[model samples]
Target chain A: MTLFQQILTIAICAIGTMTTRFLPFIVFFRGEETPKYIQYLGKALPGAIFGMLIVYCLKNVSVLTYSYGLPELIGIAVTAVLHIWKRKTLLSIAAGTAVYMLLIQFVF
Target chain B: MKIKALKAAFPHTIPILTAFAFLGMAYGLYTRVSGLGFVYPLMMSTAIFGGSLEFVTVTMLLSPFAPVQALLMALLIQARHMFYGIAMLDRYRGMGLKKYYLIFAMCDETFSINCTADIPEDVDRGWFYFFVSLLNQSYWVISAVTGNLLGGFIDLNIQGIDFVMTAMFVVIFLNQWFKEKRHLSSWIGLAVSVLCLIVFGPDSFLIPAMVCIIALLTFLRKPIEGGEDKV
Candidate 1:
């Protein structure tokens, strides 16, 4: 792809992505009251997001293979222990990521 | 005067900035390695700010997919953004003219930052929130552009990449879990997802688990909270 083509592609994608985020604001309610659907989404969205995030993180997990499985096990273990013992996000993430990478490179 | 906003906004944004910077670097490295020029990563970061979407876009780009395909793929991967906007309607209504920008910038990090903070009694929450929102977007844009530019010269191994996101999620999840006055919903989420993964196979179980988790949380919330505003 040429420079111009790449530039165009990025522009189109940026517009689309921003539009998705801004759709509700653009299509204003124009009424004083909060819309029913928005209210429903407010009630429902947070828990759903939290759930989706978990599934998202574990998206690559598989039970049969050592390729992704063992590393995930190690990650979960390290996360659980760090969470209980130290309760620091950056530390826990670093520890888990280090374990996962080491396992992926070294261990089965 | 605006510097106050930047200072107020930047501290809360370090975690997000760090994550975006490294991930942006990875994407830029991928861009150069895939035979595209430096501008591609910068432009993509500025444009397609979605986390999963950018990763997916790389594969599509390697194949050099058609424009329509890229558009549809962006929509599908970020289908959740529609919901994110819907939930923000009431909160954003007060932004007046800046409402549209709020919608554009509200990613997972932005939403979490918006939702978690206890807006002080007399503070200019509008400005504070706006600055934070803008700061998040700026961090992403700057990191991506810098990474892409740097990608032109640097050559290094970039394996174990996806786990950066995973590690952050696990860390955030753990942080939320420990501090949660009531851990019922998170525990439900964790258990339900694992069970669904075991039962339905990885391909089909996720959405169902999400739905079930929502249902369970809604029904169980009253008892769990004992009628108090936790967040």
Candidate 2:
């Protein structure tokens, strides 16, 4: 692609992305009462979204492949356990990532 | 007020700092190796700001110049942001012009932290969200540029460090789980996502998972709102 074409492609992507991000807000514009259904969604969707995000992060992990996602599973276990035990967000994330790094770098 | 909010928001973004540094650099390196100049990754990272789509965009840029296809692919890949927009509708309201940037910068990480972070009452909510979004994007943009410049010259033994993103999401999911009284939504989200992933494969699973999630949630709205399931 030419330089102009390349820039256009990136611009197209930017527009496409901003469209999805901004559409809902434009439809539900402020100061006007949000729809009952949308309001319900605003209250209910975050929990589900968080769950989906976890799965999204691990979407590429193939259990049938070599090592079998063990590193990821163990990492999550450490994270959950540490978070539940201490409730320190940073600590849990750091320790879990550290364990995963060690596992893949050495154990796996 | 802005300074206070920035301080409060900084800690929440620390994990993103580490995760984005690696991921963004990897993206930059990929772009550089793709025969593109550093400007491509730098501009794409700054303008697009969505990680997955930006990575895909590199390939799209390498291919034929299909603007329509690029645009559609971008919209489809980013459809999930609409969910974040819906969830944030109320929270982002009345913030004046800042709301525009918040929505524009609402990548998965930014949305996750902004939606979930417990901002102190004394701090300004708008500024808190602003700084989190700004800081996260800055990490991504700067790292992308650095990676493009370094271009395979540096090799670190941090192979699995990308797991920080997964770890962060897991912790966030667990936090949400502990906070909510009912687990149905969380269960639906997890179960449906896994099922769709298996059925459709990772590449195309998200939209299906999202569709199923919304449909299931709408179907169960009555029971969910009625507070019938206390478990």
Candidate 3:
């Protein structure tokens, strides 16, 4: 692609992205009361979104593959246990990541 | 006040700091090794700001020019942000000028942090959100540039390190789990996403999964809001 074409491609990608990000804001503009359904969704969506994100992160892990996703499973388990145990965000994340790194590096 | 917000926000972004520093460098090296100049990664990271699409943009730049395909693919990949914008409407409504930038920088990690973070009452809320967005973007840009400049020389055994992002998400999920009294949405999200991952595969599952999640949530709205399972 030519330099201008590359820039246009990037610009196109940027526009697509910005549209998604801005759509909700524009539709539910200021001074207008947000519809009841969307309001309910706003209240209810975050928890689910967080869950979706968790799954999104592990979407690439396959049970059929070698190691069979054991490392990811173990990592998540450790992260959950630590967070539930200590209630510290960074502690759980770091410990879980460390366990995964160790499993892939040495154990697996 | 801004400094205070930045201080409060920085700790919440600690995991992102680690993940982005490494991932940004990987992206930088990938761009550099693709025979592109450093400017490509630098500009993409700064302008696009979305991690996955920015990586995908590298391929788009390499391929024959097709602005239409690039735009459509970008929309498909980033459609998730629409959910984020909806969820954030109320929180971001009154944030003034910072609101625009917050919306602009609403990548997954930044959205996760700002959405879940319990900003202390004394801290400036708008500034807190702004700094999180700013700091996370800065981390990506800095690491991307560094990776491009220091290509191939800073190799470490970072093989399993990408799990940092996964770990971060898991922690956020757990935090949300503990906070909400009802687990229906959480379970629906996890189950639907996993099912979609199985049915649709990783590369193509997100849009389907998100659609399912929204449909199911809307279906269960009455029970969710009826306070039968209040959080």
Candidate 4:
């Protein structure tokens, strides 16, 4: 691909992405009242969205393969346990990541 | 106000700082090795700030220049952002012109932090969200450029550093779980996603998972919203 085409391709991606990000706001403009259903969604979706995101991050992990996803499993366990025990977000994440790195790098 | 918001926002983005550094550098290195110049990573990282899509764009760039395919791939991968936009519609209102940038920069990490971070009452919400988005994007763009420029010299044993992202999300999910009275939405999200992943596999399960989640949530809205113990 030519340099121009490459830039165009990137621009196309940018356009597509911006569309998804902006579509909801555009559809539910602020001038009119947002429907009750959408309002409920706006409140309720975050919890599920966060959950979906966690799964999205680990989508490629194969429990059937080598290491059996033990590294990811243990990593999540450490993160969840630390957060539940101490309630420090950064501490939980940093420690969990360190443990996972060690596991994948050596133990696994 | 902006300084205060930045100070408040910076701490929340620390994990993203770590995660993006590795991921962005890897992307830059990938771009460099893919026979592209630093310009590609720089442009793509800035224009297409979404991490996964940017990585895919590198491969797209190497292949035949099918603009339609690139656009469709981007829309498919990024369709989740629509959910973010829906969730953030009210939260992002009344921010004037800054809302545009906020929506534009609402990648996964930014959206996660902005959606869940308990901003103090005195701190300005708009600026706080803005700084989080700005800081996250800065980390990504800078790391991508650095990786592309120094692709050959920076050898580090960071095999599982990517797990920081997963770890961060897990923590965020836990935080949300603790905040809510009911775990119905959270459980639905997890179960439906796992089911979809098993059924459709990873590459194609996300949209289905999202559809099923919305459907289930909509179906059970009575119990979820009525504050009844239906879980």
Candidate 5:
């Protein structure tokens, strides 16, 4: 793409991102009562987002029942246990990723 | 104050850096593989800073796809930020002129983390928010540049790399889940989305599922438990 094209795409993306991210603030955030609907969204959105997120992360892994499933499953299990146990973000990622890389490189 | 703000942002932006750096490195390396050089990642990072959007950009660029289609898809994928913003109304309101940075930095994790954090009484909210925003972007830019440069030297079998963000989301969810009450609507969302993905097939289900999730969550607000049960 041309320089102009990159700029235009970036502009559209920035605007779209900003609108979705910032517009809600200018509308509902200024007042007394925070909308109950918004409240409900906050409660529920993360779960749905993360649920999709898990699927998204695991999507690339081929699932012929058990062929390439070990590493991904182990990674998830490690991450879950570490997170629930340690509650340390960096450690969870590092340990999980490290274990995963090691598993793929050496184990499976 | 500005300098302090900048400094303050560095520490809070650690996760952003850790997460984006590997991805950036991968992107840069991919640029190398795609018959490009350091200039590509640098330029893309500087001009187009969106993380997943950058991946989409690579796909579109690598193929014969039109820029218009790539651009639309980028926006649609990032549409979830609207939810992030809405989640941040209370915090964003208190921010003064630094609202610009806050808005820019309100990417997925920063918003989620900040929403959970109890803003201290005496701390400068603007600086706190600005610092995280600034640091996160810098981390991404730096990582992408590094990855591009390192691409030549490394032969990384980096498939499934993009899933780090997804994994991070799962980590964050699990982190929050045990602390917080069950969000029934989101479970409903998961069920509905998987069904949609199966029915519509992978290509067509995302936007529809997201729409269904958002609509269902919005409506389920009143009956569900209050959003804040944990930190």
Candidate 6:
């Protein structure tokens, strides 16, 4: 691809991405009374969205494969436990990631 | 004032600093190994900040150019951002000029942190969010440049460090799980996504999972809104 085409392709991507990010704001601007359904969804969607995100992150973890996803399983467990026990977001993430790194790099 | 907000937001962003540093380096190395100059990765990361799409763009660049296909694929891959935009409508409202950048830079991690983290009352809300977005972008860009410049010369055993992203999401999920009284929505999200993943496979499960999630959540609106226990 020429430099022009490459730039165009990347620009297309950037534009596409900006569309998604800005679409909701464009559709539901604060100047007007937002619909009740959207408002409800706005309130309710985060819980599920967060859940879906978690699943998204783990989408590739195949339990039937080699190592049987043990690393992910233990990693998630450690992360969850540390978060719940300490209630410190950064610390829990750091600890869990550290454990997973050690497991995959050495123990696994 | 901006400095104070930056100070407040920086600590929360430390995990991202680590994650993006390595991830960005990987991205840079990928571009470098592909025989592209540092300019490509730098510009891609700056303009198209979404991690997955940036990775995808690498292959697209190598392939025969198809502008329309590239655009459509980008839209499809990034459709999830629409959800984030909707979810953030209220909080991001009244943010003024920072609002535009906030929306533009709303990657998965940024959205998760800004959405959930309780910024102190004293900190400037807009600035706090601005710092998060800005700092995250800097980490990614800097690391990408480093990797491109170093070009496979650096090696470290950071094999599973990518799990940091997963761990971060899991931690956020747990935070939301405990905060809400009803686990119905959370469960629906997990079950539906897993179901979609199994049925559709990982490659194309996300859109279907998102659609299923929205459909189910809309269907359960009466009970979910009324209260989960009432269902």
Per-model C-alpha lDDT, please? 0.63, 0.83, 0.82, 0.85, 0.65, 0.83
Worst 10 residues of 3 chain B by lDDT: B222-231
Candidate 5: tens digits of C-alpha lDDT, residues B1-231? 666655555666676677777666766755666656676667666655666556555544554435555544555556667667766776777677788677766777677557765545656667777777767777777887787777666676654444345456557667647755665754765687677777776555656767777777667665556545443
Can you write out model 6's per-residue Cα lDDT over B59-170, one digit (the tens) per residue? Answer: 6797778887678668756776887887789999899989999999999889989999999999999999999999999999888878777775657555665576677678
Native contacts present in candidate 4, fraction: 0.80
Q: In model 5, which residue pairs have backbone atoms overlapping below 3 Å?
A: A20-B82, B9-B131, B25-B147, B28-B148
lDDT of 1 at B194: 77
lDDT of 6: 0.83
Candidate 6, true inter-chain contacts retained = 0.81
**TM-score of predicted chain B versus true chain B for each candidate:** 0.65, 0.69, 0.69, 0.69, 0.64, 0.69
In model 6, the runs with Cα more than 4 Å from the true position are A1-13, A28-30, B1-41, B48-136, B147-151, B228-231
- Chain A TM value for model 5: 0.76
In model 3, the Cα lDDT at residue B226 comes to 77
TM-score of chain A of each: 0.58, 0.72, 0.72, 0.73, 0.76, 0.75
Q: In model 2, what are the clashing residue pairs, if there are any?
A: none
TM-score of each: 0.63, 0.66, 0.67, 0.67, 0.71, 0.67
lDDT of residue B165 for candidate 3: 62
Model 1 alpha-carbon miss at residue A55, Å: 3.7
Candidate 2: segments with Cα more than 4 A from true spot: A1-13, A28-30, B1-41, B50-140, B147-151, B228-231
Q: CAPRI band of model 2?
A: acceptable
- Candidate 1: C-alpha RMSD to true structure equals 6.0
After the best TM-score superposition of candidate 1, give how far the Cα of residue B163 lies from its true spot, in angstroms: 1.1
Best by lDDT: 4
**Model 4 pairs in collision:** none
Query: What are the runs in model 3 whose C-alpha is more than 4 Å off?
Result: A1-17, A28-30, B1-41, B50-103, B106-136, B147-151, B227-231
